[model samples]
Target: MLIKKAVLDGIASGDIDLLFRTWDAERVHAGSTQRTAIGVLAVDAVEETDPAELTEEDARRGGYASLDALRHDAETRDGTLYRITLHLAGEDPRIALRAEIPRGRELTALRDRVLHMGDWAVPTLEMIAAQPGVRAPDLAAQAGREKRPFKASVRRLKELGLTESLAVGYRLSPRGKAVLSAVRRATASA
Candidate 1:
């Protein structure tokens, strides 16, 4: 209810803090304004950021120091989290609704629940299950589709309650793991 939207300018390559802030997203001309919701909490780990308007250094100034700094910052701001949506002013010219994990929330767990279900919830879960560590775009590439399909699939998976995200690409829920495990076991038994 007390949500304040923000933007970190000049973000070239960086990561998202999927801990506290959880932006309710829509992919418009700016970041995440497509009138869509992914329901997953995922932070982007920018590796090669290059926004036409924003720069990588600008990203660092906005709120990305290092693992330790980010963790400390998020930990301290957990209660007063400010949701942010990341967008680049580069070729894309539109910002992706970055994250809502800022410093506080009315129901933190709810935000977590939404984040648990991400842009590519199911595939992302499988990728994480297989690799335990992967990237969002990697999942997208593996999905063999463009950005929208990959992002949308993950959103669907989140809507289905099978997966959620936390900064990392994605992880399986108890239900998801159970299902995956069952499938694996059945295949092995067969």
Candidate 2:
């Protein structure tokens, strides 16, 4: 089920409102191209279904049933999510989605990196997670920096795969959530 790039981009970035708007626009603009029937149904289900549930059937049907369900599936199937995002982007893309880190040595390494980011990085990531749809300019204002530098700093977080860029701003990756939790637990116990 091929969804348009704008729609996938919106969903990945937690822009459900934008997604709805874009979906409706596409449905209205449904002129020449023969739309994929299942894709339309899946998006409709996402729009209509309250208390949505994911199932093997939904997977086979090949699209998300709801924004929550999509987020859940993204956490569980990060590679697939990433690939879909990349595919939607088309051509060589600068940014890509990433899978969460596995445990043991990699986790330990990441923890060390996180700890050594001079205290600000984790907190920044936490802030981004807390404000899901906030834009970069707003975040820069909050951080008391000009937008360009603040955006560059956020890009650094993206390089670590600890955060993702949305159409508007940013969200922590699943790995980011895990690292934040681990760090909190470690600090709390200490």
Candidate 2, position 55, lDDT: 41
The runs of at least 3 residues in candidate 2 whose Cα sits more than 4 Å from the true structure, single-residue gaps closed, are: 1-97
Candidate 2 C-alpha lDDT tens digits along 143-174: 77789978887777776777877778888888
Error of 1 at 89 (Å): 33
Candidate 2 clashing pairs? none
Q: What is the TM-score of each candidate against the true structure?
A: 0.35, 0.48
User: lDDT of model 2 at residue 124?
Assistant: 78
Clashes of each: 58, 0
Alpha-carbon local distance difference test for all models: 0.43, 0.55
Per-residue error for 144 in candidate 2, Å, reads 2.6
